[model samples]
Target: MKDQITHLPDNADRSVAKQKFKITNWPTYNKALINRGSITFWLDDEAIQAWYESATPSSRGRPQRYSDLAITTVLVIKRVFRLTLRAAQGFIDSIFTLMNVPLRCPDYTSVSKRAKSVNVSFKTFTRGEIAHLVIDSTGLKVFGEGEWKVKKTRQRTPSYMAKVASGS
Candidate 1:
């Protein structure tokens, strides 16, 4: 079963207290997530030096384990599997020893924020009819804004909380 976040503390204070993330019955979620993961085609910046030079240096100091290739691999796995951040986090953290990833898996926020930074453009592959050749494109979209409809309405659906977090 997937996780669902129905409501959140709209104005939760950060420094006042902390709510740690934990996953119980992790064996099942671990198997579920990993079984769903796959290593398919990948897109990466080939020119590492050039790519690094293009971005501003972080003030936090030298690169950390967070920058390791294994992390990127897992990020791709998460993407290919289309798992949410929490699912990935729980899944990976539960099986760190088994997978032997260098760093303990990052929490959902870290994984989601880092991967979500890759919103620049998308690369697509399409094939033309009656030909062996294929077409590739990126950043494809149709956009419209400032539109409203009175007849169309939105409704919220009810959801049951998963017992994994023990009702936190």
Candidate 2:
């Protein structure tokens, strides 16, 4: 039966071959790498024109100063940059000043109050191409006493690890 043996006796031959990939388009690859770390800011003319309230005055409370579109636009900038309401206000104001767009930015209070009613629409970054997303998570022990303290205190509680990811 030894002569008819069909399987290898060792796992050395069962190992998978390492994959080798070639980057054929160096210019595109380099541009993509550079863009990964780049930040872009854009403001269209239509947004500038519709910055202030255009609707007829309501027969109720004080008339609104900024339009819903303006509030939504500022809120979106806040979310994207992870900035405070005040900071977002200043940031947008700076952008307008630099672009020479004579549009008034909504204050933090106005933006916050209008946020409850404004329908903010966030657009996905897709250029008519299939986007492949890769997500990796790592758990980290953030809070808790040391192991020696736990042993001495006789309080062996389960530790909770926090998972943080990039671009999250």
Candidate 3:
């Protein structure tokens, strides 16, 4: 029995493909780009009032100073900036100072404890609205070895040197 090789048909016109999507609303796109860097740290009066009013004490423990919303906000800020819990607390404190808001920011311990119970909600577009999403991804290979083991075990030999040393 003989094996047969199959070949795909090739196109002669090898031209670069043009982009399919075009920006229709430049102003909206520009505004979105601008707003991406603008982090709104100032809490509104309603939010402040809600936070203050949510300090009702439970029967077993002391009164809560921070609300779930406040803790969730701190967690969101931490995630957005990729900050540690301590760093997030400091960042929130700085923002509060900058905004001159007379509200107490949650400590790192409080934020960590409340984060597990905080309920977060994200806004969704209506059914009639259409959203275009473009996703791009790159693959990364990870080695599951400690740095010390990797350094100790790593053997470097050129391909020619390896071939010659093996007497091949």
Candidate 4:
């Protein structure tokens, strides 16, 4: 069957569309935005105490300076920002110094090693109520030769579309 695709209007203005939607809870939304912008690198006293009271290594290896909680925190930050291990290490170090936390920050190597066996669990936020989430995506227009032309000239499958076509 022929593709039943319809193109969007060329005159559509994103700014105008955005202006149409009004925020109901501006204060709550603003607070959430501000909180999201502020990164909490240092753990509170209760968290640090809990980490200290937890299990310790029984094996006769090098004693770790930073606890599992600290390492896990670094790993989570790394994952959220899509940073390299080295970059994550630098980030944690900077944050620690800025916050004036007297805790030892783990090296990138230690974070990498500990991350292999770390169990990061996220708590469920729903209070026995069904929640719905909506996600929208838009395609980016690439400024290059069209796929058909490139494929014909190169006499090979285009790399961009190869994965979907070949299941790779």
Per-model CA lDDT versus the true structure: 0.38, 0.59, 0.52, 0.50
Minimum summed lDDT over a 10-residue window in model 4 is located at: 159-168
Candidate 4 achieves a global lDDT of 0.50
* Better structure of 2 and 3 per lDDT: 2
Tens-digit per-residue lDDT, 1-168, candidate 1: 989967857676554666887889889989967754432221223412121223345777655334323334345435434687677667656554554433355666655555544432222222211111111122112111111121244532222111110000
Top-down lDDT ranking: 2, 3, 4, 1
User: Cα miss at 91, model 1 (Å)?
Assistant: 2.1
Q: Give the clashing residue pairs of candidate 2, or none.
A: none
Where in model 1 is the C-alpha error above 4 Å?
A: 1-65, 68-71, 100-102, 116-168
| TM-score for each candidate, following the candidate numbering | 0.31, 0.52, 0.48, 0.46
Per-residue lDDT of 31 in model 3 = 98
lDDT of 1 at 57: 56
Better of 1 and 3 by lDDT: 3
Candidate 4: residue 106 lDDT (0-100): 73
User: Candidate 4, residues 65-121: lDDT per residue as tens digits?
Assistant: 665566666665565456988887888677657767655557888878877665554
Question: Candidate 3 — worst ten consecutive residues by lDDT sum?
Answer: 159-168
Flag clash pairs in model 3.
none
